[model samples]
Target chain A: MPAVVIGLADDPDQLSQDLQSPYPILPVGALFSASERQHLSDQYTPVEFAAACKPRFLNAVFARYPTVETLLYADPNVLFLHSTQPILDRLRNQTLLLTPYLLQAPGDTGPGKKAWPDEKHLQNIGLYNADFLAFTRSTETTQLLSWWQSRAETRAYIDFCKGLCTDQIWLMHAPVFFGGITIVHDPSWHVALWNLPQRQLHQRETTWQLADNGQPVLFVNMKGLFNPDEGFFPHQTRLNPAKRPDVMALLQAYRQQVAAKELAALTAIRPAYGMKPLLPVVRGWRRTATTALTALNKWVDTIYLPALPR
Target chain B: MTLAFTICSINYLAQARTLGDSLRRTNPDYQYVIGLVDKLSTANLPADLVPDYPMLEVDKIGIPDFQAMCDRYDITELNTAVKPFFIDYFYKNRPEATAVIYFDPDIIVFQPLTELNKALETNSLILTPHTCSPTPDWERPNELHHLNTGVFNLGFIGLRTDKIARAFVDWWKERLVYECRIDLCEGLFVDQHWVNFAPAYYQNVCIDKYLGYNVAYWNLHERQFSQRPDGTWLINETDELRFFHYSGYNPFRPDDISKYQTRYTFSQRSDVKPLFDLYCRELLANANEQYTKYPCVYIKPPTIKRYQRVRKAIKLPINRLISLLQHR
Candidate 1:
């Protein structure tokens, strides 16, 4: 039987609105209520979602499944990246797959020149593409869940933080600490909307034309683009106030084009203003070389090296 | 002859250059081996200056260290020593010889390379790095990560023209020729690090010895060296030194070496410590006439407000950063 997988997320109601993927949906409840978060409040926040949602949801999965291998765990913001075959190809062997995000370069002001010294908030928290993740049934995931359930019940949030969220904090050392399986930052598998993941989006600028041939979008993460009134201006994207009206209107239209599956109309949407070159991916080799490299690299160091090298 | 290193040391004494002269003066034949890569074509060459020694211009082939890889010739801007026409001529006519050594102009060769050729007896692609011990932190030398790669100093390399070595050089050339950019990959812009895994890619690559052949400044740790009992200089362990690279701390004011006192300044090998006495013999013998002004000091209005700030900012962090480079 094909494995049943689920992607979990919380903006409280983010997945609830987009609850119409090809897979079944389960909305994780808020870990802490708004009243519990009264001690510290966000000017705007998901202040207490992960603590409330994750363990409750993951525990439900653990109790039902004898092991995690029978199912796949995914992040809510991820959309299909390549045709489903590329993902299914990965499923042939691996138990876990993940994408690594650009950590704040200890001194990286931000991505570009206007990177003011004051804007330097936290050092790069590279694990940020925390949006796309997969879990398989194994001693590692089981152990991970065991540790997580206990921690989530306590430490709601700590400050060097954008906001206290549970799912990301639990993974502080998943790759190095866990027994090791297959975790990937496969550009073909999933991409976050802004930052380093922005490179993947640029690679796909011409991909919409190619996607019309029944290709799987694999999973495209539009996590940064869901501001309700703002619609979709890309997460962390900055625009001049004068030109903001046109850019926002075009992006909104692009989101509609994506939703409507009007591939040609979406192609007309212009890219955001930025100078970093779109990272290139060698095509045709995606199914063979790209996927193989990503999976192999994960096992060689983190999981196996400890047991063998020592 | 089995092999010889031909350096393209153009206008080396000029501030516009690097250790090309020092590279040649490593031993007796160092200068004789170097030919300046110049603006003129073979047709434009003066009748007496036969192209006996090879010089390269473009960011390709034998010319591995081109303008694209470096930001400066000792902090000078790009496109400084470009000989635009040299590549068109050499690429078309240069012979595929047995071996070639392209040394940096600033490099001072202390001894003849008899053993360097013997090491290349296998006919494999040969290359050298400054320090290959991968260390996590060069600042904290004791840390396990201070493994510095001496690859960036292109002062000396031994290459033979058989199939495997040619294939390797061609691969390095392709990288520097096409994708060379100083801004890429944390400013390790020079495509030298490719040497690290070039052996894996090409069948015949070899990471030459770490200490004796391609020595650089980074390797000196807690142990100091002194003239040995056998008349050879000794560091902590061995004194069988093949080459001593005077990489940094040049005597810019000539008198810095005369009094044995360190000064805050920048000048060529002729002005620094005894590091380049042999190479700069001609220049220094006459230094009393041309560059007679001694005790010259280079003081800049401090970038930081206080002396403590210098230690707090540049000194410690830069040291840590060096250790980090070595670690990887």
Candidate 2:
């Protein structure tokens, strides 16, 4: 099956390397050009940059490609380490694949339990993360577009310039609307930064990730970090970098694997991240390092605001 | 003692909890029963929010109020009852609690319900009728005409745990024994409105007066309300209102929750700016957090049929320009 990775071509360079994934990548763009696409409202809103780019990104992909069998999706920031066999295995018989929300609502009672918050976050975010999307090509995609089209007909503009509708709410019942969607959410597929620190790089799930999910890492979704802003790997969340020795060991014997220029290109992009000399940077962020000490002093006022007591 | 039973399913639980917490605070000793439709769990509500009260969890009665149905057009928990069945499990099993009082999680209490209890003096059953009629002829049970449930609004009811209330409950059981509907063609057989007959047969009191009780929408301006120098609201043609049951708009904020409690609701359009902002803040602070109201939406026609005549061209632009100039 030809797996299609559908995401907006916000960064074409990342889209090119992302094309070399285990499954083929299908880059989508919005109706507007990239320069004109970055629309923002004057008010400070809780909706993030990538989330605002949803309607255009969605319109681009569904309108462009008609034959999508499987979807291997990622955000522009997602970086690959090795061939993602485990993820594909889970999604083998699936029609759609999505990850769990990384940001947990306060007082989330874990899975199969109570989830209550006396107060909803005042942050007016469109609910769903439009990051990675996986779906088979069918009439199902049109159903979503029609539903969204009906909502957008109102032409009401609310917080975040979202036309008063939330992006996340649209997909909440996608399965019910578009039959046969397999929500494959292994943490290995989407290792987000909200749940990871430099120390927990070996294992981090998105949205308050835990440290010990024993499954082998398939693909690393390199999101939530923004620093050098060139290629995919040059983001700021790479405070401490780890060479995937585990992946290196697997590919060491495959001589033909060297031809996968995507891996080499990903490696070459690493130097631009400023964390080039990894061993020293790790020490710099670690305790007893003067960089760590000085950094804390500089950010204390900004970071240490009075918290709403738990 | 009277029993009040309010059921809030998981759908409106957020708004329900806010109302529940406030009611619990205002009437600490009142007989109250909270029935959760599905009995879901939550971290937001503290365990002590409703201390020493019995929580009845049961399957959704599967009834919808026509008004609440339209309310859903605007926008828009459980415990105890689990296992084999809820009624036999909660009512038959529990001995410590004598009566049940159910409050929709949306209601917030502004004052102690000493008045409702006092109203329960003679009758074994007490009910607050819809403060104002949905229409003029709503009271007559024409069947085709919408039933005036205020004649039997379950919003607040008192049931004598003894003969009368039990008999009413017994009657309700037999009626629900057949095609039980909380709301039907022009009547409801559940949601205490079914108990409207309890008063005719058993004995009940109907709370009727627009003295700021229940969902009363005063249309005319001068008739809406009167304010004194001391800031106490005096409903026109009336001396005092027990509690201004905020029914139309948001009851928590001043702009919505009328009766001169605070000017927050209408403050945005007021002459006094700083005071408006400060008063809104205070009202919001007093606004109970338990209820996160989900507003409903409705598809409204652009204009009424009488106004539809304006679509004939000449008066349309003239009216529009006049309205715009007036607005400006």
Top candidate on DockQ is: 1
Candidate 1 falls in which docking quality class? incorrect
Query: Distance (Å) between predicted and true CA of A116, model 1?
Result: 31
Give stretches of model 1 more than 4 Å off: A1-310, B2-11, B14-96, B134-152, B184-188, B222-224, B229-231, B253-328
DockQ of each candidate's interface versus the true one? Answer: 0.02, 0.01
Q: Alpha-carbon error at A40 in model 2, in Å?
A: 9.3
Global lDDT of each candidate: 0.40, 0.39
Please list the residue runs of candidate 2 whose C-alpha ends up more than 4 Å from where it truly belongs after superposition.
A1-65, A80-96, A103-128, A146-185, A197-213, A225-310, B1-32, B35-328
Q: Tell me the TM-score of model 2.
A: 0.33
Task: Write the residue-wise lDDT of candidate 2 on A86-176 in tens digits.
Answer: 5556665555665544322233222343332111111122223345665554565555555544343222123322213234434433433
Which tens-of-lDDT digit does each residue in A46-149 have in candidate 1?
Answer: 32333334555665675666654534445444445345555556655554555544311212232243332111121112233355555556666667666555
